[model samples]
Target: MGAPPQPRAPSRRVKLFSAWFWLYLVASLTVFWFAVVIPWLVITPFDRRRRFSHWYAYTWANHLHAVSPFWTIVVEHAERMRADQAYVLVCNHQSSGDILTMFSLRKQFRWVAKRGLFALPFLGWMMAMAGYVGIKRGDKRSRERMMAKCRRQLELGNTIAMFPEGTRSTTRHMRPFKRGAFVLACESNKPVLPVIMVGTHETLPRDSWVFTLERKIYPVLRVLEPIEPAAHDHDPERLADAVCERMTAAIEQLRAEIEARGGLEVRPPQ
Candidate 1:
């Protein structure tokens, strides 16, 4: 019998096209920011600037996802978000795309990002202008300043989003949770809202700019019940542990649900 035909490798031309597509999209968005977002932000009142910037960011993220043919995003329990209450939002960090997935919540919140991220040309400038908090790792003084800024935002009834894992996990398993977000929640007396994200790592792994092609990337995010500050007696360590446990469990459940639905296969971090 004749040898069976071998499966063909993905075409190099297609890979190049995909990479170029992302580069073009990024350039287009940067132009849109300078041409539209920046002009409006400059004219907006200081008091409303943060909210306006967040809205613009949310619009940009959604627009990017909408234009990407290989991506699909699903969010559950988003209605659990209470419009009247501000929370310390914490989530697992898997990929850079997690930021856009979080924006799918469409909630108003300032991000606690690395100081380096805030130094990027246009995006970093936008983040600073939008009043997002930045922390310099290993610098005690910077940490103090970041926390104080976060506390002020909480006092003003603004939510703050943080990735308690600190950095993207290299493997499917989550890295150790950091105490900063929990401490901020305790000090600010804001409830801790835990969100679980799955499938983002597969879509866009760490340190890579190219999108995985020819596959449907279904990223799922679930908003779990918020943990009231009183539940942990204002203890940051206990609060952190409790939140981490709940999020771990929730991720497992989400994985099982995805498996049952015959959607994209979610792999553990390496």
Candidate 2:
């Protein structure tokens, strides 16, 4: 099997277009900002779950993909979802672009992000409005509150989404899984839904934004079969490790498939 493809350098034209895209993105976001806020504020009073916030945020975030025609996201196995069944979703954190890529799932789940990110001027406040959960690293008390809140959300029949690695990875190398998400799965008796994401960092590299058309950059999100609550026998550590192992292997397989098609490159858009 081939190793995961490395990031490719962008041509001069792509770089210039990226600069312009960013400009257009910022303006669009600014223009649409109020549309989300007004509805969120009105609905927060009646909808304790802020379910509308999730949909609004999902819609708003997905616009990031409208920048270029060549930039497309491929979603797989989405049919596995069933209406009204809440779940605990765990996915690998590859790049910041995931903030946008994830919305493509079109599934309603409260996101668990770092508390620091929730403090970013407008972005953080928007997250707050979306009712996403945030955790403070190494702050035991903060973690406790986060876990409590997540448990409550689960009890309310709302799905919870988290990156068990705790933070983003610049490459395909994932960090150790954190136990919080798995613990929730066990305690809440909710099945764990593992998702495999590939090619996100290459599309929007952590250290840089440059990308080349030398190969097609297909950001794929694959939702795997759910792991029943009994699969881990109520053991959080076992659940975490089991999910991690399967996800790691699945990601490797996905990358190998992509590599087989010739270096993540596709013919330039016509």
Candidate 3:
């Protein structure tokens, strides 16, 4: 028999076109910020900014996803979402695109992000409007301040999304989960919801902005059931490890399932 037909990858021209799409979207969002979002921020009441910003970001991100032929996002377990209750969302860090998935959840949650992201011109402004908490790495006071802000947000019945590993992982192996998210969850007495996002790394991997479509890329957002606070309320450090173990196991199971179904093609080595 003749050789089978190979999958048609995105042509360079298509990639280039998608690049322009991103640029145009960013530019448009900028105009959007200055013309609409910014004006409302300045004039709107403080309490109202949170809701408005979440709405704006969700709409903008959805538009971005729609225009970009680069990604096919499949959001699962959406029915499990309880908008009425607050949660501490924990997810693996793979690529910057993970940020969009966070906004995709369409919840008014404050993200615990590195202070560096707060420096990207329009992106930083959008983040600020979204009520994200910025943490200065290696600074104790910064960590405390971030935790304090997180606690307050949780108390207010607002969700908080955190990549407990602190930085993006370049491979399939997840970075060691940090204690911040677990500690905060314990202190705030909130449930921890584990999230698994596959295929983001393939979209825009570390040190490479040039989008690659070696294979059709479709990222999935799967939310595992919540992990309620431990009954003993042990030391924060110990509780953190327990939380990490749970997340690690969840990731492994998801990875295996994805591989078994042949849904994910790229499993970058640790």
- Cα deviation in Å at residue 192, candidate 1? 0.4
Flag clash pairs in model 1. 171-269, 171-270, 172-268, 172-269, 172-270
Alpha carbon lDDT of each predicted model: 0.80, 0.79, 0.74
RMSD of every prediction: 6.1, 3.0, 5.9
Better of 1 and 2 by TM-score: 2
Name the candidate, 2 or 3, with the larger lDDT value: 2
Per-residue error at 147 for model 1, in Å?
0.2
Q: Compared with the true structure, what per-residue lDDT tens digits does model 2 show for residues 1-270? A: 233356457788778777877777666666666667787677889988878888877777677675466567888888775558788999998777786888998888898888998877567777888778888899999999999989988887788999988888755678898899998899999999999888777777765655545444667888999898697789999998899999989988987777776644542222
lDDT digits (tens) for residues 1-270 of candidate 1? 222122244357547756876787668668757865656656666555277777777887787778776776777888777878899999998887899889888888899999998878778877876779999999999999999999888887889999999998777667899899988888888899999998887676676665554565678888999998789899999999999899988988887777787756442232
Name model 3 segments beyond 4 Å from true.
1-11, 14-18, 46-49, 231-234, 264-270
Each model's TM-score? 0.89, 0.89, 0.84
Tens digits of per-residue lDDT, candidate 3, 240-261, equal 6666777678766766676776
Count the clashes in each prediction: 5, 4, 0
